[model samples]
Target: MHSQQQGWAEQQDALAEFGQFALSCIDLDLILQRACELVARGLQTPIAKIMQTIPESDELLIRAAVGLPRDIATTGVTKVPGGHGSAAGYTLVEGEPIVSHIPTETRFQVSEVVRRADVVVSANVVIGATGEAFGTLEVDSLAERTFTQADISFLQNYANLLAAALDRHKAHRERVANAEERSILLRELQHRTQNDLAIITSMLRMEARRAKRSETRRRLESVGHRVEALSLVYRRLYVTGVTDAVNLSAYLDELVKRRFLMHGLEHDDAVKLDLHLTPVEVDHSQAVAVGLIVNELVTNCLKYAFPLRQGTVTVTLERVEPGKARLTVADDGIGMPDDQVRGHGIGLELTPVLAKMASGDFTLEQRDAGTAGHLVFYIPDLRGGGSKPL
Candidate 1:
């Protein structure tokens, strides 16, 4: 008799191992099925069933079962009462564990479907972290058998593990959803950037065509170059997976390389561009304004300043203080004439306008050399976070 009992206990331990392995390998449905199987075998019962709460629904649905016919067990929906009864629903509602040893009728509003079970024993164990009702584990014996506290404790622990697994699945699903949303937003932003570039190109082409003279055409072509520089900044931003703002130094270097320097100025008389930039980030509007301002300054240096000669056009950017920045464009070329200085020319007029857009000031002056010109401007920092380098 002692040897036989020891063998049976070993078999029960093996069944527990199988239950754990099955729960690990299978989905929620299979976990429930495996739970029913384990409980039925451990309790030496003829039938076992697991019931779960339907989200937003007051009814408890039979999720899994063993031994009993599925068709008979789930013939109808079972409405669980709010409190104080022997039914699984009532046990869950009252936040308590319950067990029944015999096929006893309880006024817990258990459906007629469950009334058909001749031998029934059930235990309700709260599984979730918040002590919320996760489900019910039930074992039915055709013969009378004692239900122990150890059995209830085992079922409760397994149910808790099952709840954690379900929560992990839910979190993963939400992460996937959030990733999909970000992908959609990025695609939309790319589409809008392309549209903006196309429009700017069209505008530049029209403006260039309407110019009556070669000089005017040249100037408008320079404007088109500026627009393209701005477009390149956005393109790099899109490629780098950044959409908010851009680093000024890197943007300026890229702009100069792509736009003006591509012309390959060989002679000392030809305009040579240089940059001295401080790390900074600017919003889209300020970036555009800065891009256009640089375009105008560089174009003017190549046109009027050098006057058919080579020259060095230096563009320097430095952070002056917490919220202010200094930008200076110095060209070693013929200084501005007194007559031309009054109106400040169209490009020079744009300098002040761009500076105002940045909420700052602008200045134009002739260097002490008497042959070179300098334009200094200040603009407010838009990025309140940390400074960035392009």
Candidate 2:
């Protein structure tokens, strides 16, 4: 009775240790190795191994083992052929644990390692969380030994724990792959959209050039510029590989340079650019609205503020507070009249509306030399809100 009680106590201790190991382990290879080691120690077996099923070929490859020859464990003896006779193969196919006296068993061919090791007893259990088996967990002894029903039950429980861990790892791998695929598709879509916008901008330019009336030509040119501003946002997204937020500093720099080049004033010494931009990240829809506002303000300065085409336009973006940003577009040229600033021209009318779309406030003020337009808005915290629709 004392011997029986001592055996029970040891079994309980082994189970407690295994539970702790399983809880702490995250890597599949580590878990498998530890499980095999623990099983070998608890069962007093000469060999304990885990064989993983290869889904493509329906073969069992030895993944982890203890008390097995290095060559047999690591090299050419890796795979166990799947069929009716092999103990591991049968356990996987039948989805049940089996214990057999290897010397007398004839239903299936024993593995070469088992034969060479002179193993007398072999036991195998299916390892899987669901009904479908993933592989087999096997234990063998060189001395003749009989495993009772309790022993078989204990091994099956261990196999079930392994199966659960494997299933979790498989799920995580799938999620990572799915996220990558989505990112690729989003980039492709942005590229195609930018191409379409470029085509439209070209068509608008053609129409503006053909117009005979000065007023009609100017209106067409303005519309073309607005479309081009929208196009620039998509271009920035493509170049930066960022789908969630726009890097304000890089984006505005490119935008200002492109605008000067478009107006045939990139090399003009009189027209200078003064940029004092800080790094900031803004959501997609907000970025588009800000881009349009900047385009309108800069276009106004180019056409009206600097009549001599020989002045400076300054663009500034700065984070004013924890969740706030301010953008300023100022020029050192002819100032706007109070009445025109209040009037409903394209620049004046659209600037305030676009500011509202960005959830910002807009203000126009006459500086000592030219006009300054200010836009202040709330920026989403990095920990939360992502891009929202315009």
Candidate 3:
């Protein structure tokens, strides 16, 4: 009686240990091997192994095993045909546990490895959460033994734990795949939107050339330029393959160079361009507002700053502090008249509105030989969490 009580106590301890293994966050293979090891020790078995079904195939492949020959454990014995021919295969197809005393059992052909290893008794149970079986867990003993219902129940419980783990892993993989798919779709949508904007800009340019009156032509041209500026932002986004933030240095360089080429000033010997920019990243909305403001300021300088188009325009962007950045566009030419400086030209009128949209301050001042436009704004740390101005 005392010996039976001691055996019962040991089984309880093994049950607790096995429960911990089931809840562990270890990799699937390691978990399976560890579970097999625990079960072998608990049941006093000489060998334990797990076999998984190959998807779309009628084969049971050994995945993890304990107390088995290295060659058989690693290379895995020949794939067991999925049916009632082998104990593991039968359990998988029937979705039920099987116990056999090899000496007396003739229902299934025993594996050559089991015969060679002198395995006299074996038990196998299906392993999976859903109704369909994924594999089977098995334990074998060298001496002929009768596996009671209680022993079979213990193996079934272990298989159930393994099934739950497989289910959780499948769910995690699906979630990750879905997120990646969504990102690709968003990028494609942004690319198409950029292409559409380019089409509209081209149409507007054609309309401007057909306008009869000089004022009407100028208005159309101005509107077209604004659209072109907006289109450039999306172009950069598509080119860089970055949907979240714009690299300000590269963006401004491209923007200014394009403007120079458009205004027929790229080859003008009288006009010189200088850019002193620092690398910074900003959200899409802020970048668009900044680009538009730059468009207006640079256009104003080309038209009015230099009376004979014979001076230099300098654009600079730099970090002012941890949470601030400043952009300056300065030119050496005839300064704006004090009265006209306050007037509502499209360039001047739009500058302040765009600056406000960008959460920035806009200012214009007369320099020694021309006019200077300055815009200071809060820039967020794009690397960290959402906008924390830095």
Q: Please give each candidate's TM-score.
A: 0.53, 0.82, 0.72
Determine which window of 10 residues in candidate 2 has minimal summed lDDT: 381-390
Question: How many backbone overlaps does candidate 2 show?
Answer: 1
- Report the Cα lDDT for candidate 3: 0.79
Cα-lDDT of candidate 2: 0.81
CA displacement after TM-score superposition, residue 10 of candidate 3 (Å): 16
lDDT for every model? 0.64, 0.81, 0.79
Per-residue CA lDDT of candidate 3, range 323-352, in tens?
Answer: 889999988888776654784687778888
lDDT per residue (tens digit) for residues 26-51 in model 1: 35666667667766665566777776
> For each candidate, how many residue pairs have backbone atoms clashing (under 3 Å)?
5, 1, 0
Alpha-carbon RMSD, candidate 1: 10.7
In angstroms, give how far residue 295 of model 2 lies from its true place.
Answer: 1.1
Q: Of the pair 1 and 3, which is ahead by lDDT?
A: 3
Which candidate would rank higher by TM-score, 1 or 3? 3
- Give candidate 1's TM-score: 0.53
